[model samples]
Target chain A: MRAPLAERVGNYLLLIVFGLFALGPIVTILVAALGPDDGGSGSSGFGNFGKAWEIGHFGSYLRTSVAVSVSVVVVSVLLSVLSGYAFGTMRFRGAGVLFYLFLVGIMMPTEAIIVPLYFDLRTLGLTDTFWAIALPQVAQSVAFGTFWMRAYFRSSSRSLVEAARLDGAGPWRTLWQVLVPPARPALVTLIVLVFMWTWNEFLIPLVMVTSESLRTAPLGLAFFSGQYTSGFTLLAAGAVIVGTPVVLVYAFLQRHFIAGMLEGAVRE
Target chain B: MSSPPGEPRKVGYLYILPALLVYGAFLLYPLVRAVHLSLFEWNGITLGKFVGLSNYADVVADAGLRAAFGHALVLIVFYSVLPVVIGLALASVLQRAKVRGLGFFRTVVFLPQVIAMVVVAVSWRHIYAPDGPLNDVLRAVGLDSVARGWLGDYTFALPAVGVIGTWFETGLVTVLLLAGMARIPRERYEAARLDGAGAFAEFFAVVLPAVRGEIAVAVTLTVIAALRTFDLVYVTTSGGPGTSTSVPSYEVYHRAFELGQVGSAAAIGVCLTVLIFVITLGVNRLADRSTA
Candidate 1:
């Protein structure tokens, strides 16, 4: 019933090699951040963090990232749940066509839309502003969120929504009171996903915001590396600073993240 | 779960309006508008000229742009093809092995997926630097002649960058294939064994045919990453040395933002979008036919 011993050993060997490939860069960076001063390549203790923080201007980038990601999550979650509720629970004349239209939104990469969007935002005088960065991400997240939640609502317990309706509750009340509370896991997964995507997003902020102060974490890190090309220790510390929040969140909620990704792939 | 409301009414429409508006204005409109822009010549600050089909021609005719597309295709070799093959190999063994610490292995391997590409690019840039660990290993192992500044060298730059894509993607492909492999019936493997199949024979006859959907998904995602990669190139090489690693997305960025070639960028964007659409659709269709 089991694989042969040699085969088992071979699998372990493959896993070990893969583990090193994946974790090696991360460990190297962490060591260069916290390990002993190998001359300028690394500095002992946490001084690199402080120095990278100041040199990279991470304080402003962090704020911009927080502001943009939170707004994206909140707006995306609200709009998606509402829309998903309709798409799932109600029938309409153009539902199928509209659903595919959103699917177009899902399939359309940022590369495809970003050019016209830049000019469009420029005409609206919003380029170089945070709204330029935040709005498009909200749109991207909502596209996925709507599809994801609609699927959830369709499969979830119908009795709850029916009971609320029978009790003369309005649609809004039914959605918020009867459904939203129980939909915490789906919403959390969506929020975490939107956060990571928005946080890691590079091109939009790169294209939209020319203002140094408005840079998000990843964009700021790119600029930081460009400026401190030779300062391996500082750059490594900066890389950690930019990547750590998402990694920590993934560490904590990896189960949910993995589940969402798998299920979402089916949606795709 | 519920039947259509007795009549579709204001509420259904109202609930969807906000999401549709954002998606419409930002995603849908821009896509359509981008296609529109591809047909004309207009700088962001200028009165436009109408130039139909020229930019698309340039996408093909311009040596640099064509090279960029070529680089993306080359990346597909490293990013998509190799990873899927490697993933299948890993999945085959792990499926048979009943490996311990599989969760830990899975998490660590998928680490690249979780990290930002910019961070991945920066870290690898250092690793590929002259005195970095990779070259150190090369020298220590008595292969010093093969090691150099990977991201800077013309000959090795594209492959070096592709290797990063490989590293990032191999984990994802492995995990996805493993997910598909788990659903395979035990009897199938037993059947292969009964047929006097070797490992290669079993893999080709049974395992390969079984995980078509996973392969489809993995290829689509990795191919898209290869074609559309931006952050990695931007941070690591900036399409470097002399355009050795420029992919279309980077060309789109460079033209629009840096060179002020708005129409050309839009044209390339439309072309890249079509390429992605056609290829991914073809992949999915092929996958479905085989599996079904």
Candidate 2:
């Protein structure tokens, strides 16, 4: 089934070009980070990362981002599994209507709701706190997570559930003891997606928290770039600092990430 | 009476309650409130006056607002159209050659999607700086006259921003289409060759139809990404060089936070939401029809 040698070579050439396009910016930034410090004045190597970490206050921002992402992922994954189990395994009144409501969360642009969401959170005195950033994102991630896990649960082994039920196991026990263990792959995918989205979210933390310490990594990076416009090395190092965790996670769980994305696309 | 697993009793409602509560409180409620706010002139602090549809009217009449929406549409060309076209071409090449390192290519190509948009914007902003790699390359090639600040140039800013979108999105589209194209049976390709169909003819007769659904999915995701582009514009240009790269999402933030035009901002948000819905619905309809 192989094509001619020339065509194969041409394919490789094109793939290489596209690969360069994709990898070029990432590689350049990494290289620039390791080059030197601000204005190329300070010592070279990993010192830039240290300086950027201190100056940008990335330690605080990364902490905020981690806290927000962890809270969002934990709450949303648990909620999505519960709800997805319902939608997948059970047919109840208003199921269709409720599922469509969840779909609206998936489809609704953040621009549509962010303004009111800010005001609403502010009214409750939740703004400028971690809950303000984490809770709203929990809602968003749960929306998509429910949809994703529902698809997984619906196609999961039915006989296992039936066997568990015949043994007098309750619905909760069936889900936890019988089904959830085998659903590790789907759960991992949900965790990865929700974590990435929560980590990379910009506009929410931008508007929700005005305190300098509460700023997430992306927000802090944006402000840092603005402040250090000419400090290319420092800025590049800061980007690496802010971006490395997600990159590392993606490198490890890329299979789940890709599978979830393609599956989501096809289902849509 | 006990119920089957597929038809669990009213307790099913309880299983969904927690998620439904949070979703409604944060997302759904805010959406409704945004629509409600769109109809009034509120300073965001005081009790607002009702302005009826004047905010919507303002969105239509204001030239800058109109231009912002226009920039989003232009971005669709770069974000959705260009990526899909390039993705199709790349997938076809791989399809023909049965590429060996497809897994490696997919991983590298899909890397951009995983990074933060702010990081993407920062990296690209560096590349587009006056003396950045791009201009350096141009000067190296003796095209020094063409070298300029890309994101600072009024005319080039939008496309410069758009090209970044293309770069970030092309990999996603390509990977998605490749997944779709891989499902085509080998015998179909062999049959097409037996019919003496050339590459173009084979693409139209066999490949295009097979991946129609993927194209729609790509368009939906990317078009939505194009319209909802705030982080990129916010980081890269701030809709700068005279609002040349301003988009609705950015305007939604700028108007409310900066200009104190909450009502108009809400109106634009409502419009953007509707625009996204209508366009995606239209895309799905067209895709379904052609495949049928």
Q: Write the per-residue lDDT of candidate 2 for residues A21-68, one digit (tens) a residue.
A: 999999989999999665755757898888888888999999999989
TM-score, cand. 1: 0.96
Residues A1-268, model 1: lDDT tens digits: 6777776677778889888988898898888777554436444569888878887899899899989988998999899999999988878888878887877666667888899999989999999998999999999988999899988888778888888989999888988999889999998898888888999999999999999889999999998888775557888888899999999999999877777776676654
lDDT of 2 by residue, B99-212 (tens): 788999999999999999999999999999998999999999999999999999999999999999999899999999998889999999889999999999999899999999
* Docking band of candidate 1: medium
Please write out the lDDT profile of model 1 over residues B68-179, one tens digit for every residue. 9999999999999999989998888887777899888878888788899999988898899999989999999999899899989999999999999999899989988988
Candidate 1 iRMS, in Å?
2.3
Per-model CA lDDT versus the true structure: 0.87, 0.90
The recovered share of true contacts, given per candidate in order, is 0.75, 0.79
Q: C-alpha displacement of A174 in model 1, angstroms?
A: 1.8
Pairs of residues clashing in candidate 1:
none
Worst 10 residues of 2 chain A by lDDT: A36-45
Give lDDT for model 1: 0.87
Tell me, by lDDT, which candidate is best: 2
Lowest lDDT 10-residue stretch of candidate 1 chain A: A35-44
RMSD to truth, every model: 2.0, 2.0
TM-score of each: 0.96, 0.98
